[model samples]
Target: MLLASAMTFSAGAVTPGGEAETIYYNARVMTVNDHFDITDAVAIKAGRIMAVGSHAQLQELAGNDTRQVDLQGKSLLPGFYDGHIHVGTGPRPFGATFNVPTPDQLTEILAREAAKVPAGDWLVGLMNRPHCHMQMPNRWELDAIVPDHPVMLACGVLKLTLNSKAIELAGLSKDTPEPKDGLIVRDEQGEPQGVLTMGARRYATRVIPNPALSDDSARDNLRAQLAKFLPMGVTSVNIAGVRPNELRLIQDVYQRWGDELPRATLQIFLFPGYDDVDTSLAELEGLGFRTGIGNDRLKLGAIKMSMDGAIAVPDFRTLKPYDGKVRFDERGPWENQKGDFNGVTVIPKDSLYRVASRAHELGWQLGIHTIGDGAVVEAVEVLERVLREYPREDHRHHLHHLTIRPPEETLAKIAELDLIVDTQPNYTYYNNAFMLAAVSGNRLERQNPQRSLLERGIRIAYGSDGLPHGPLLGIWAAVNRLGHDGKVYGAEEAISVEEAIRAYTRGPAYLTFDEQERGSIEVGKVADLVVLAEDPLSVDPLRLRDLAVERTIIAGQELFHGSHVEPYHQRPPTP
Candidate 1:
């Protein structure tokens, strides 16, 4: 990063040099341009693509001082874009592997992390896998590894395993009252087990000294997490859920790095709680800047609204109950027990409409998280009402995580409204098997259905809800539509390699209103790109998850080079 800050853009425009200021030839350049074209060579100057054509054609523009890289028959593509990621702040995994930890491995990981922290501190992480519930780690098992640190390893949304310290911290003694929407499991003796489920886990999360609480700590932690994105060819992201604290993180990034920062669009938080709409709107307007603020490296983009809760929305009104055969659990006051356990709208339709309408009227793009089909329908209802009230062109507002089977009519309505979507396609590959069983039985075919989304003329962008943040895994899931068991998942809903590529690149660029500037290898666009060892489309779909990004370049500067030739980084951001 110090190396990055040392350089700055010069006064004059950059032109092609003898070696052609970094001419990449003998390569499969998937332009992902207007026609989804493929070409061999591309010449770039400053940070913009100067030409894209045959090697002989672009060689004419090379200057004596130009640097060159002979791709030697590799593949190059527009840098990947993750449309919906919580790149700013969240509970990051504890292990170095950064994937699902097995039953035995989870304990070992806690041990390793425990060795790093003081005996009294906390160590926490998720079980990353869906079936982690089947291999639940009890208090004794956790105490065996990191006994000193108050440990809480969330095995699933509703399952939590707390060490004695964490339990003590939560004040969960035998006499403690059960959390309204949650349960504290008991042992044979009626003493609290290390498990507190659903709403009960919130008690611990409330008391934990989360790293994200400190601005400097959050910034450093975010960088550690984001460092993984570059080597995977992720150049841009729509960082979801920018609350007041997250705003401070973004501002910190801008203040520290400026153009050297990774490209991102912040989806500012807009909750639908009591007077929350007015409060968020007033805060946003009071800030004196609406959406689409800032330069290329960082910009304010969408306004976020979680229409439904994840699990707590004790809240998510689904078409059916989860884990149970029917909606049999204790219901919250806000819970909608209308049809089984379909999730409930945390923000009622009236509330959502008001917030959305105000956001639209005030010039903010919306990215509402809609989990169940039931939620999607309500989102559509809100969108229809808001658009009718305050219309704008190419609004590009989107619904996030439209999971499970969406009815054809809802998909049609999304297309009719020109609404965009962002989904974690990796769910297909990693979590599909369990999700197929967990969701409403009728909607099995719509776990993600990204292909269906694209076919219906809706722009679908890919995001990783952190099973794995690698875009290659997402691409593999999009193209193969297979679960971890290697079974076809929504076979008919599988997208082509090119379409999947588009979702990771141009599709997201459009969401950020940055398509014209980048997202492709077209001449005159920013040189935000990557080089790969092989063409992603031509490779076995199963091998995609392991595909390597040899070089990652952003704005004509090499940001990440891995097991490849040393890439030049003398140039600064494009003027």
Candidate 2:
């Protein structure tokens, strides 16, 4: 119905100006407008879209100076937007190319890498394998293979296994007090077993020496890192959990090379680990800047905080005790874990509530990571109370990595509060088996409930969260709802291809307050679009991930051209 109306309305859709700088025709253009319109051509003037309609209708806006390009039956779409991501972070040193490496594979790789490095040098091995498969070697076992090197093996971000040398180098001992929101795992005799969790993992990371690079080198690395998304059809990304120094580097890169980088909104990470609530609040006040501080290219996004531990380790705060029936192949985080097994809350309740209230009062958007149902409920309750005390329309406070759906009433509250969700659908696809083993089947079915959330009029967006970041994989995971083992975990929650695309594009734009400027191919919106070898809507849903980006254009400039398209930059400048 919407598509029909869009076509009918196109007859009267006015072109922006009399002359255009370029006109692209003979393509299947998905405007992704209010109607999700499909148009035949689009005209660009300066860096904005001038018109979008039938080829004949748009041709009237073309002038003698305008350049014409034929898409030759390709498909055009609004560039993808990753609602949650990380900058300056990639695969760990000597880690497997595949994010998830089996334990045997990881140990062999680390051993080989250890031999190549100089004696006494630190060796860090990071892997994205789920905690269920994270049967890591203890310090003694690691010492057998890499005795000369100080080694730290990080499993699934939150868990860490360090050798004796690494512990010595980090200056940690059984007597060392545990950091706030962190834990030092100990054995029967209370000796440090070379294991850390949550905030405690920073001890190892802080002691790991890094290669110093010049500003130019750092900028080049940032540019190259962001450029990788262009070929994947991603044009805008919201990088969360960035430190202050990291923010400066990001700002510098954008200031110097704005045109070459993806549109970025960085969520400044805050709280007990990085800084106390008071200190962070003071820093924001002193800076005199809040969310939405920059232009379309780069912006200061929300203030992010993690409310609970990671889901991969099944250490996230939950409403009830874990079912605990599933067991890992070997000794893992949950293998013999004690207590109620309800998981840990990274942030104290009072602290989380206070920060949420204060941040909202100060006009800063909050992006709280709430992976467990318990955390989600707490966040919703706090936000509800905060809004009642100090209501602000369209605050756009979002919850990141909502791995489980809260109760229906809490969800209703979320809908009523207009809370936005930025979740990694690919996480559900990639870690479904592990998650199923960790949580109850009922909880697993409620995971990534995109369709249900949309039905309730709640806004949601898809992101990569740095685990093999790609919007295509996210969209595919969302539409298919398939696990790594080829099982459908949440069949009822599966969304259509069009719905997933919106979650990747317009949904993220709305989250970042860029809806009117660049989410769609409107007359005045920025011309950020991707030309695909095949139309996503026409292809098999299972093959969506295989779709190739032929050309990526941002603000009317082509930054990446695949083999299917002629290099626009190499062409002579239009006189």
Candidate 3:
């Protein structure tokens, strides 16, 4: 019988010379190394890979106390790295759908929530699936429901619907001048309409105290959230726009859980108009740390900035005007007068360059979110100027989500600059319909041009951006380029399964400067791996997302034994 644990031998047998602590054998080990080689087995010692070769070859390196796991001919690969995600440090908001809620239903829900809380307390709600075309409730409508409590309904991270009380509490009025790069929706009478977009949303959110910032249970909640990644074979994640308090909380979770939780890299975003460039830079430098601080479990990464809104919301800055028609359903078309609108530019050009220059000089990488073609051009121009002036090598400054394909010259400049492209393949799968409505057919055809970008020698990394943060889904979407409608949207953009896997694994490691140490299952690297039921390289591209993870191992220890767990004394981690 296969030994469930490492065999115990005399203390003298466990030597540090060349003995391995564990030998995982009888499996197809896809070592994502420089050569992308395949082996039969692998041996681990002291939380690092010691050897990888045939089962017989590894057996010679195993000590008497070495653990041996017979994989029964499963497929093993390096653990996945999620390039981008938003791990919220606040309590999850009460959720409702943007498409389903009627005025009465929304009012009823608000009334119920308002009654549960104290009169002066804040009541926050979230629209589960927010889109640009959906009709939003006005402040007057919300005031009719929860008059006493300050109500703020979030439509995504960038937009909010606030009641009059919330607006009052936030100190925003009709006369309150609009932020340089934010929008405060107004009525015909020149009064605040209770709708805030972009940086303006921060005003309401700042006043609403999130108990998770100081609550002890936040550690447990964060631990639980990080634990969820193990089941999906995600060993590393880079979270964008993390606040100071949230970073502290993340550290606490890692301290308690140690290697059991996924490794995290954080990016701090400077809110346009909300965060002063000079003051923010001073405060960051005063912290006595730049990017790449903290330990292996948690590290500071880039300073992120959103150049424009989300593409699906179609407020992303664009060179040409939007196609004024929104065809969400087959029933009919929704038309809006989008004449001469080239979308919203969140940061002024001067502010972007000033902040980027200082951050670069301070040894911080810049991660700018540019969804539209115009935004991409603007960001690239600024980066070009910064690099020309500073000329730092290996900066790895990245542009996130090039949803709208930029000009050929701009794309060439990106390649010339050696910048990384952190994009979400799952966006095509989940938001294709909305995207088609948001932009012209010609523009939509080039959405996430993975193959084109790869051809230009651009290192494109795959991320979920919270569109269901699963690497399998991202891989499937990247390989198939299929939408929810069961039709391929951008077939030319489809990549190979191997390419998709590399993007999800090795490509992201480049962002964290862990490419040599992690990302691959090479000898001398950390033994962070996942055992799959089938080989992803050989699986049908369409069924790739259905592949199951049999086990997840980090640092040579099995943290998650997948679905068919034999009931031993200990229970496995749960999602």
Candidate 4:
């Protein structure tokens, strides 16, 4: 088996170096290389780009079996790469709930879902963003809807809102003190308010029996999610924070589906609270998985760690207190005193540093989730210390969601350390109101710091964070720098469409150390590409999200083709 594996690797490395089998012609293809060149056509053979040049130049290599596809004056480009994604988790129950903008919407959604589900069963909802009109619902509201069932709604970052029944089921009460590195929000009456932060929620969730998600079910759901991404021109995603069981499920899908599993890299983060670093590392080694272990279809990339909470929840480690206004109530005073708010860190800085240092020593890349200024500072500090103590070449430690501060010194240090910044630009659109009101306030002008990071030559990448994973929507948010209400914040930090594209592609590839194999449309690279309805460069920046995907090809196989939704046919439709 070892000999066979070696032979296969050797064979794959040796390029076909032969005639082309297919030619895409008469279109603009953005290579996204250093030259930033656009070509008229691209030729492919053996699931690799054979040549990229004029339509006629590449057509010369085509034989009688060659397939020709005319772009009809449309656009073709390297598929977008979402730098950070929670891929193992299944789809959120969006349609089951109401579409309103406030907590009323959640109430309506819960009421509706409760009606459909049998009594005394768990009712789970996801994708609840804080700072929206739909403020995080409390246990009281959930109890009113489904008093018998245990309802758990995950809202922004690692916070979970549980119904009174859920608390009872989990045996959580006023006497149940907050766990280390976790928070349990209480009402003014000192009753458990249903909000469980960080490790506490995970603990409660583990005890409650999950709705039996099988590997087959997970695979099917993943395919559905991938289809949604392909239409939006997303070709690749980095699955951040996957556990061992979820990794097995992903591997099963990849083995059966092969390249059809979507252009992706799976980075399994050992949840610090669940597994020891040594045990997790041993498990990865036993699976024969090292960083950058597979083809473009799937690969083990980095180790992820969620260091802090999100800004919208006001739990993020901030350099200063949240703006002097309540997040849910506008006319109220700030929640904390006027000073530096350390925010919440799921793992202590010292512990996080130790974990990262161990991973670094073992030559594994590190990806840390840092949203608050304090979290960012702590992460950077730890990374710097680790590098100095045990120097390793090409240590690509990433700071995921550098939301609040782009401190010039820290940005420069990141560049110096060669660390990557994984940012979620779409959140700017979905949570812009919350950002402007609760997090930034008058300092909204200095938020994000995209421009500052770029100026310091920091490596940056863009991701949707999966609540909304459309590349065009992310690009629109970056280009516009405005919220839904037309209020623009930090206009100076906004980036061009081209730069945003680079962040989605090359930047992420560089971070994962997969730049050589993917992230661009070039000869010898995997044939993972997205055919677009309109030229991204030529389209109006404001209408970028309007652009649709014509098709998505992964390893020269058409995985998803754009077409109108058709009704499900049962038993041949009575033919």
**Residue 119 in candidate 3 has what lDDT?**
98
lDDT of 2: 0.76
Given candidate 2, what's the lDDT at residue 58? 70
| Maximum-TM-score candidate | 2
Candidate 1 residue lDDT tens string, 255-371: 786455468888887665544667766766776677888887888888888776553223344545654232322223222224344444556677788778877988888888887
lDDT score of residue 397 within candidate 2? 93
Residue lDDT tens for model 4, 121-159:
777666334333225668787788778778887665466
lDDT of 2 at 551: 84
lDDT of 2 by residue, 1-575 (tens): 11223222133333344578888899999989888989778888778777788888776667789899999989989988988877663324323222325555656777778777689977776654543233556777778777898887776667778888998988888788866566676665556778787878778777877656677766776777887788777889998878776777788888888897689998888764334768766666665778889888999888898988776655677887776555543234443356466666788767777777887888899899998889899888888889999999989998998888788998888899999998888877666544655676778777767877888888998898865577878888889887765668778888888889889999989988888886788776788998889988988988877777888899888888874321111111110
Candidate 2: residue 506 lDDT (0-100): 94
> How well does candidate 4 match the true structure, expressed as C-alpha RMSD?
7.3
* Runs with alpha carbons beyond 4 Å of true place in candidate 4: 1-18, 89-122, 126-134, 148-150, 273-289, 324-334, 337-341, 441-443, 563-575
TM-score order, best first, reads 2, 4, 3, 1
Worst 10 residues of 3 by lDDT: 566-575
For residues 175-278, could you state the per-residue lDDT of candidate 3 as single tens digits? 88876555677765567878777666667877876543454767776777778788888888988777765677888778878678888898987754335767
TM-score of 2: 0.89
Give lDDT: candidate 4, residue 83: 82
lDDT of the candidates, in the order given: 0.71, 0.76, 0.76, 0.70
- Model 1: weakest 10-residue lDDT segment is 566-575
